[model samples]
Target chain A: MNASLFDILTIWLQRPNFIAFIILFLWGLYIMIAHHNLIKKLIGMYLVQTSVIFFFITVSAKAGATVPILLNGESVDPALYANPLPHVLMLTAIVVGVATLGVSLALVVAIYRQYGSLDEEVILKQLGE
Target chain B: MRHHLPVFVFLLPFGMAICMPLISLVRPKWCRGLTMLALAAMTGLSVMLYSHVIAQGPIRYALSGWMPPLGIEWIVDGLSGLLLPLLGSLALMGVWYAGPLVTEGKGSIHFHLLTLLLVSGLSGMVMAGDLFNIFVFLEVSALSSYALVGSAGGRALVSAFRYLILGTLGASLYLLGVGYFYAVTGTLNMTDLADRLPDLLASKAVMAGFIFMLIGLGIKMALVPLHGWLPDAYVDAPDSVSPLLAPLVTKVALYAVVRVMYWVVGGEEVGETLPILTLSSWLGAVAALVGAFLALSQQELKRMFAYAGISHVGIIVMGVCLGNPTGFAGGIFYLLTDAVMQAALFYIAGTAFYSLGIRTLADLGRLRGQMPWVIGVLIVIAISMIGIPPSGGFFGKWYIILGALEAGNYIVVGGVVGATLLTLGYFVTIFERIFVDSVSSGPAVLAESPLSMRATMGMLAAASLVLGLMSDPMIRLILDHAFPG
Candidate 1:
C-alpha cells in the first residue's frame, strides 16, 4: 500500500523473474548443444521447453497475488491473483511437449536398433561426410 | 449444418483413423481397400467444403457449441478451405500410389494405420484455429511421418531419427513460443490472441513468442539453414512414402505460418507495428534463392525434388511477407499448386526408380529410350515446375511476381525469377536426356509400368493441367471473400 514497500516489492518481482528465466533458457540451450546422445539431447530439449514454461509462469505472476480460483462463493480480486489462463495454457503445452518427447524417443529407439549408436556425431558419419 | 464444414474437415479423418487399425483383423487386402475408400471420401468432402467456403465465405465452427476466446474453434476460410482439399487430394493420391508399393515391401497393417493418422494430423493442423491444438496435430503428423520414413528399413531408419531430433527441437521451440504468448496474453486461441496481442505489443515476452514461433515453424517448413533434415528424409524414405510426405507435410507447415501470419497475427496491421516484420520477409527471400540453388546442384532425383520443394516454400513465404491481400492469395495458390505438382513429380520419380532401378539423374540416361511412357509423364510435371504455359506453376509464379511488384519489392521479384529459371534449368536437363538422346538397353532392361501406377501418374498430370485452367475461380475464391481487405 505504501510507496517504499511497493517499490521494494516491484524491484524484487522484476529481478528474480528475469533471473529465473535467463537461467532456465541457458540451461536448456546448454543441454541441446552439449549432449551427444540422441535421447539425452531430446530430454535436454524438453528440459529447455520446461524452462520456457517457467519463464511464462514467473512473468505472469502478480505481486502478493493469491491463486486464481473462485473461493468461499466469492469472486477473487484480480489484483490479488496471478492469471489462471497462462497456467492452463502451459498445462496444455506441457502435454504436447511430453507427447513430442515420447515420439522423438520412439524414433531414437528405432534409430539405435538400426544404427547401433545414439551419438549424433556417429550417426552423421554413417549417413555421409 | 453446412456452416460446420470446419468440424467435419477434421473429424472425418480422425474418426476414420481411429478405426483403420482394426481393419487388420478382417484381412490385409480389406484394410488397404478400406483405407483407400476413407481417403477418397475425405477428398470428396474437402472439395465440397472448398466450394461451400467459396460461396458462403469462411465457415467458423466453435467446438461443442462453446464460443471462441473461451473455447477452441475451427476456422475454414479460403485459406483453410483451400488447404483442406489440397491435403485430401494428395493423401488420396498418395495412398493410391502407395498401396501396391506397401505390398511390395510386405509392410504390416501398421503401415496403413500410420498413413491414416498422418492424413488426420495434417487435415487437423490446417483446420485448427487454436495455437495449441495445432501443436497436438503437428505432433501427430510428425510422429507418424517418422514411422513412415523409417518403415523402409536400413538407411531410412537413420534418416528418420535425424528428422526426429530436428523435428523435436522445432516442436520445442514452437511450444516455447506458445508459452510466451500465454505469458503475455493468457490465451492460445489464434483469434483471441491476435485481438489481445496489440495490448502487449511492447512486452518482452511477446517478442520472445515471435522469435520462438518463427524459428519453430521455419524448421518444420524446412526453410534454408533449417532444412538439413529434408533431403535425407525425402531421399531415404521409401519410394511409396516420399511423394506423400514431401508435398503435404511441409506445405501444411507453411499453411500454419500463413494462418499465424495473416489471420492470427493480423497480417499488415501487426507487421507494421511489430519488430520481426522486415526480418521475416528478408529471410523468406533469401530462402527462395538459396533453396533453388541447392536444388539445382543435387544429382539424386528425389533429393532434387526435396530441394525444389524448399525453394517453392521460400517463394510462398516471400509472397506472404509482402503483407497485401493479393500476395496472400498468391502464396495460398502457390501452396495448392505446388503440393499437387510436387507430389505428382515425386510419384513419377519413384515410378522410374521402381521400374528402372535408377536413383541418380546421371544413371537416368540409361532409361532414355527404354521408358517413353514414364518420360512423357516426367515432361508434363517438369513443364509445370518450369512455370511454362498451360500449367498451374506458371500462374503461381505470376501472382507471386505481381505481388512483389505491387509491394515495390524488386528483390523478392528477382528471387522468384531466379528460382523459376533454375527450375527450368534442372528440369530441362532431365527432359533433354529423356527425349533428345538414346541409350542402349542394359542387361537389366526396363519393364513397363503397371496399370495402377500409370493411372495414378496420368491422373496427377491431368490434375496439374486442369488446376492451371481452373485458377480463375480458385484465385477469386481465396483472394476476394476469404480474406476481404
Candidate 2:
C-alpha cells in the first residue's frame, strides 16, 4: 500500500509508451497541417493514419506474446499470443488505405494535368481566382 | 421463412453486383437489364422484409452462423428494415434513369459499374451487424461514390476528389473508434458492444473513441460545420448520379450516425453521460434553418436542391437527437419519405436538363412550354417535398412533429414549423413558375421526357401519395414488429 520507490519507478516506465504515442500523433498532425502539396499531404495523411495503426498494434501486444495462431498444447498457448483482432482490422484498413491512395493519386494526376501543380494553393487560385 | 427476408434482401443485390461486371461483358446493354433486374429483385425482397418485420417482429440474422458477442449479426429492426426498401426503390429509379442518361462515350462503362457498386455498398451498410462490417461497406459506398461523382466532367472530378478525402477521414475516424471499442470490449458485434459499452464509458480511451466516432460520423452525415464537401459534391455530380447520391447515400450515413448514437452506444444511458444529445439536437436545428435559407439563395437547380437536402437532414437529425422512441420513428420516417420524394424531384429536374439544357433556375423559363409532363411531375414532387398533405412527405413530417410535441421539445416543434415554411419558400418559387404561371409565353407545347424516364418518375410520385394514405399501417409496422423486444 506504501508509495515505494520501486512502484513509482514501474509507473514511470509505463509512461514512456504513452508519451511515444502522443509524439507520433503530433508528428502526424504536423505533416497534415504544414504540407501544401497534395501528394505530400497525402503521404502525411497516410503517416498519421498508420500512426493510429501502430497504436493499435502496440496496445494489443502482450508482454512475451507469440503470434496469434494456435499450435500443439506443448508449444503454443492462448494467453501467449498477441490479440489478433486489431491486427486483422489494421490489415483490412491498410488495404483500404492503399485503395484510397490509388484513387487519390489518380485524382491528383488529373488535377495536375488541368491545374499544372499539385499544390493546393495553386490549384484553388487557378480554378477560382 | 419470413424471418429470413433480411438475409435475402442484402444477399440478392450484393450477389448481383458481384456478378454484374462479368455480365456487362456479354450484352453490354444487358448491364442496364441486369441492373434493373437486380434492383427489382431487391425491391421485392425489401417488401417481403417489410411485411415480415411488421408481422413477426424484428428479424435477426447471424452471419456465418455466429451469434452476437462472438460472431457478426445483422438485425433488421424497424429502423433499418424500412430503410432497406427505400434504398432499393431509389436505386431502382437511379438505374432506370441512368440507362438513358449516361453519356454514350467512355463514361458509360464506368457509370454502370459504379452504380452497381454503390448499390451493393448501400445495401451492405443497411444490413451490416458489426461496426467493422459497417465501416467496410461504408468505404465501399464512399469509393464508388467518388468514382460516380467524378464521372460527369473534369470539375466533377475535382469535387469528387475533395469528397474522397473528407469521406476517407470520416471512415478512418470511425475505424479508429471501433478499434478502441474492440480494445475495451473484445468484440465488434453491435449488440454485444452495446452490452459492453457501459463498463468502459468511464475510461479515457473510450471517451476518445466516442469523440472520434461522433465527429467522424457527423462529417459523413453533413452535420452543420462538417458539411463543406457536400454542396459541391452534390451540385457537381452528374445528373444521372445526383438522384441516388442526393437522397440515399447521405440518408444511409445519417442512419449510421443514429445507429452509433442510439443502439450501438445504448441511447439514453450513454446519451445522458455526454452532451451528444444536446449538442447534436442544437446543431440539427441550426443545420435545418441554415440549410433551408441557403437553399433559397442558390440559382442553380441541383445546387439549390442540395442545400434543401442539408436542411431536411437537420430535421431528421433533430428527431434522432430528441432521444425518444417516437422521435426516432419520426426521424426514420422522414428519411424514407425524403429519399423517395427527393429522388422523384431530381429525376424530373434531370429530365429537364436532358431535354432542354436548363441547368440553372433562370433558364427554367424557356423550359416551361417545352416539357409540361416533366414540369407537372416536378410540381407534384416539389409539393410533396414541401410536406403538403396527402404526400408521404406530409406523414413523415407529421410524425416527427408529434414526437417533438410529445417530448415537450417546443424548440424542435418550432424548428420543424419554421423549416416547413422555409421549405415552402424555396420550393413554391419553383412550383409557381412551372405550374401556376409559365415564365415564358402561353403554356409551351411540351414534349414529354422519354417513356422510361416518365415511368420511373411516375412510379416514385405514386409511391409518395400512396405511402401517405398507408401511413397509419406503416407506423404500426415500424413501431410494433420492426422494433419489438
Which ranges of candidate 2 are over 4 A from the true structure? A1-34, A74-77, B1-8, B104-106, B432-443, B483-485
What are the fnat scores of the candidates, in the order listed?
A: 0.62, 0.30
TM-score for each of the candidates: 0.92, 0.92
The superposed Cα distance between candidate 1 and the true structure at residue B178, in angstroms, equals 2.4
Kindly report the docking quality category of candidate 1. Answer: medium
Model 1 segments more than 4 A misplaced: A1-13, A60-72, A75-82, B104-106, B199-204, B274-278, B436-439, B443-446
lDDT, candidate 1, B228-331, per-residue tens? 99999999999888988988899888888777766666666666557355466667778888888888888888888898888888888887778776776777
Q: Which residue pairs show collisions in model 1?
A: A65-A80
Cα-lDDT of candidate 2: 0.79
Candidate 2 C-alpha lDDT tens digits along B129-156: 7888898889888888988887766678
lDDT of each: 0.79, 0.79
When summed lDDT is taken over every stretch of 10 residues in candidate 2 chain B, the lowest stretch is B476-485
Each model's total of backbone clashes: 1, 2
Best-matching candidate per DockQ: 1
In Å, residue B393's CA in model 1 sits off its true spot by 0.8
